[model samples]
Target: MKIKNSLVILLVMAFGVFLFQVYKQHQTQGSLNKTAAYYNTNTPDEVGASNVVTAIVVTYRGLDTLGEVTVLFLTAMIVGYILRHGGKEKPMKNNTSEILITAANVLIPGSIILGVYVFINGHLTPGGGFQGGAIIGTAITLMILADPLGSVKKAVLHITESLSGFTYILIGLAGLLFAGGFLDNRILPLGNLGNLLSAGAIPLIYSLIGLKVGTELSSIIASINETGNKTA
Candidate 1:
């Protein structure tokens, strides 16, 4: 026991030292001023987005964002596959109180509306596709809690996922064909900055992303809920 305690203490000391070294290194390196300045100055004109963060995410680093979405898609697919058999089993009855159910029903629509609003205004404001999708997913969670055994429209979710993903890829290909590079946000007219329809393909791409992510997360929620029902 003494030896175990000593080893634990040694490990903690080593971890603390490592963290201190990392902190010191980070302090010495400072911020990348040149890169920051360039993005700040050039992003507005080049991407035609009022929000530089949106420009970076939906335009400059679009491929990276796509890759992230792809990874999430794959994970969701795997999880759904693993839980497929659960759909055949009888569901455990929902036992939520009337007040809880009523609250969930009341809040779900508002959450979805807010989610859509966030993704729609992504290029003009602080929020974006991922944030909006998460909000929608939360609404789904509320619905599931209210009615655990209820079926989500699997066909609609699948279609939304497939269509959105296909459209995003097609838009990227179009960018490669017509614009500066792959996933370029300039395939269509940029229009006036801060407009709902402006920022070229940004709003469209992000809208697709929001829908895809929301549906994907909902599917995951469905799978988990079904699996829980089966076990119960």
Candidate 2:
């Protein structure tokens, strides 16, 4: 088995080296294609985003992003399945210090606010829905730790996740019907370039994504915590 593993690693390394050499050979002869130039130069005007990265991700490649979000949702479903068997466990008595609980209560609101800010400005700033969602998930973790007996509502999370996903799909369809193409940012009127309302549909889509992700992750965390209590 060790010999087989070594041979497999060697084969993979050699294949990677061969691919790298081929890429290097082509790199010298290749220049920026028309598509690349167009994406680089015209993305801002076309997508109405000061953040080129956001434009490419949520506008030019929106379908791929949606697919990725779907995969995450599937993962959440799997986690829910695993946690189902342990859901009968009663919540453990809270042992967290009062100070810790109070501090968490104070900070959770701020974390949620920060998460919203990140997703809302995704088209104009560095952060986006994914990052923002993770932040909100962290806040959920704090909430669980602060009061273990105060269970997070799985039903609420489910509703939030479903609504956000449905909204995202509706927005994509709207773009197809009303704009230049599917996931086009021009469906709604584009406001000022750097303003909060400038990037049509992108911000709304990202906000939905953030909410979906945050709720899914929170549900997963709740499930895991419940499972842990059963084992404990």
Candidate 3:
């Protein structure tokens, strides 16, 4: 009875905290802080990206983005290593529904194409590398769900992930060397705004990010699926 009362009190306190946070956010709504105001005022002239959020993420705070990707890579590596050595392989049961299989076949290609389009035009649109890469990863996940025993080419994923990460770093280094600072998009011509080729190196940088994120996510999903198969 004492433990139950304590639990109830804890829950009420947590709920009170949540309400306080919500009220605080409401109090501060619709206000652009100094950082936001600065980004909004100067991002167009400086970064040339129509998507202000992407400009901030991929350029102004690019080192943070690099660290995020690095963390994701390490997570994938750890998950793969642990799962790969967890147990011996066993044949996966083929219990997937035909509807799911058919849907995966039909949607995977379109999904991949959309992912590519999203990352390539990230500077001009609302979507960016992370969103696009997640879409690609979802498609691969769907494929895995459809066929439990299907083989994913880990070698290709590894290669693509490595190359993209390497190229991403090189692009950042190029910006540091030739332009304003690290990951500065001004290394290449900014070109005409709103055009496909505009935004200098942002599109290229986002493309590399998309590829790296996609491959890393796919590799992680494949590892999980393989381990599930072995355990099943």
Pairs in steric clash, model 3: none
lDDT of 2 by residue, 124-159 (tens): 899899989999999999999887765688899999
TM-score for each of the candidates: 0.91, 0.84, 0.92
Better model by TM-score: candidate 2 vs candidate 3: 3
Provide the overall lDDT of each model, using Cα atoms, as 2-decimal numbers.
0.90, 0.88, 0.91
Quote model 3's TM-score. 0.92
Find the candidate with the highest lDDT and give its number.
3
Question: Could you give the candidate ranking by lDDT, starting with the highest?
Answer: 3, 1, 2
Candidate 3 overall Cα lDDT vs. reference? 0.91
**For candidate 3, lDDT tens digit of each residue in 107-152?**
9999999999999989999998998999999888888888878767
Overlapping backbone residue pairs in candidate 3 total 0
